[model samples]
Target: MSEHFEPPEGGNKKVALLIAVLALMLALAEIGGKQAENEAVAKNIEASNLWSFFQAKTIRSTTLSTAADAMEIDLAAATDAAMRERMQKRIDDWKKTVARYDSEPSTNEGRKELTVRAKAAEHERDNLKARNENFEIASGLLQIGIVVASASIITGVVILAFVGGGLGALALGFMGLAMFAPHLLF
Candidate 1:
């Protein structure tokens, strides 16, 4: 008597390839998620630092004064030929700097932290409204980055799942890392 065994229908090579793809995707997802979280946390820290910077000083006098000084050169009041030109140039320079400040990120990270800090400052006292507005204006770049990074991470996860490998485990590990980062970091 002779006995024989049949090979599985699906190619093991294909299955292995699929598994590899899944593993890669899972790794990507894990990395992306961690980066997104880290970026957000870093941004938050920078924002907090910015807020602290402003809080430590008198906002109305410092930032606004510098900005205003840059803005007002008394171009109309002509003391002399060179004075008018100098004043005009000064005014232009001030406008440029003020515009930059207006367009900068509140914290080094961007608006998410700035916005949160601003809202908190606003609810607490009237004096902070202006500062919050400043922070909000500065937050644009970081905000866009954060949004993009988070979206990419979410999309990566979806793709990892579709690849159907050991992603489920990887995702669980990622979540655990995310939850524990703060404690681990500090």
Candidate 2:
């Protein structure tokens, strides 16, 4: 009498499909994380630029006020009409620019809007920074989870292999080591 043994069916293909699925999921997660990071950096850049612009405009307004005050004192001491006219024209130009800025439809709304947006963006930047920091921590934790999971999976495979191969040998009396015996022995 001959004992015919058949190999397991579809085992390799099933394992291959599972591995591919896990890989795809991991890749998609990585892409999502990177895209979120890019968006955060972009928001941070806009916030930084707006903050710098706000500082510059504040400085410009203060300097213009100082210059106007100095010119007023100088005009009181001066008797030259031509010099007075030139100085007055310079002051007028500054006033006109201010008026133009106020009246301009494009950034007239945008000036106020930008100020509001700048403040919001600054808040958003801080949030994004914290989000990225949290993401980093999460990524590290996810990496550890994957490593541990992979180790557990490998250990399961090893246990299966030892049971399948060693059990067959033990059943045939090729290995008599009691330590390698099946669960029934224990």
Candidate 3:
């Protein structure tokens, strides 16, 4: 009888399909990680700028307060009425400036406003970082799944392919959580 030949099973096709799905998940994870990282960087920069502005306001307010104290001393020792009146007016103006620097809502550049803004930016940065962490972990898992699934395809091992596919599914779960509740993982 002539020798008979038979085709191999379709396990390689399944592995290839798993690899394709894992690659797609990896791509999505990468994109999400990049977005979260960019947001974190932007929020960090905003917080830093706000803190710097707050410091500047504090310094200016301190300087004005010091000047007002000095003028008060001069006014106490002044022997002339006109000089005393001028000194009092200057002291009042300095006090007004200091108060405005402490809490001016119109300009939104005062210490109170700046502090609030800085804290808000910091909070946003924390949220971005949490989301980025989840995305990064998902990206790692997906990358591993792609590699394992590729190996399974080469070796014709269906079990390995299933394992890789499981990892990819887990990664997808993490990606979903990152989009919805990033704080859950953290």
Best-performing candidate as measured by TM-score: 3
Candidate 1 versus the native: TM-score? 0.32
lDDT of 1 by residue, 126-148 (tens): 22222233223223322333333
Q: In terms of lDDT, which candidate is stronger, 2 or 3?
A: 3
Backbone clashes in candidate 1 total 6
Q: Write the per-residue lDDT of candidate 2 for residues 30-98, one digit (tens) a residue.
A: 554466567668887887777666566656656776787788778788799999998888877766654
C-alpha displacement of 165 in model 3, angstroms? 1.3
lDDT of 3 at 157: 61
lDDT of 1 at 154: 46
> What are the candidates' C-alpha RMSDs?
17.0, 16.0, 3.0
- For candidate 3, the TM-score is 0.91
Ranking by TM-score: 3, 2, 1
The order of the candidates by lDDT, greatest first, is 3, 2, 1
- Global lDDT for candidate 3? 0.89
Q: Locate the minimum summed-lDDT window of 10 residues in model 3.
A: 3-12
Pairs of residues at least 3 apart in sequence or in different chains that clash in candidate 2: none
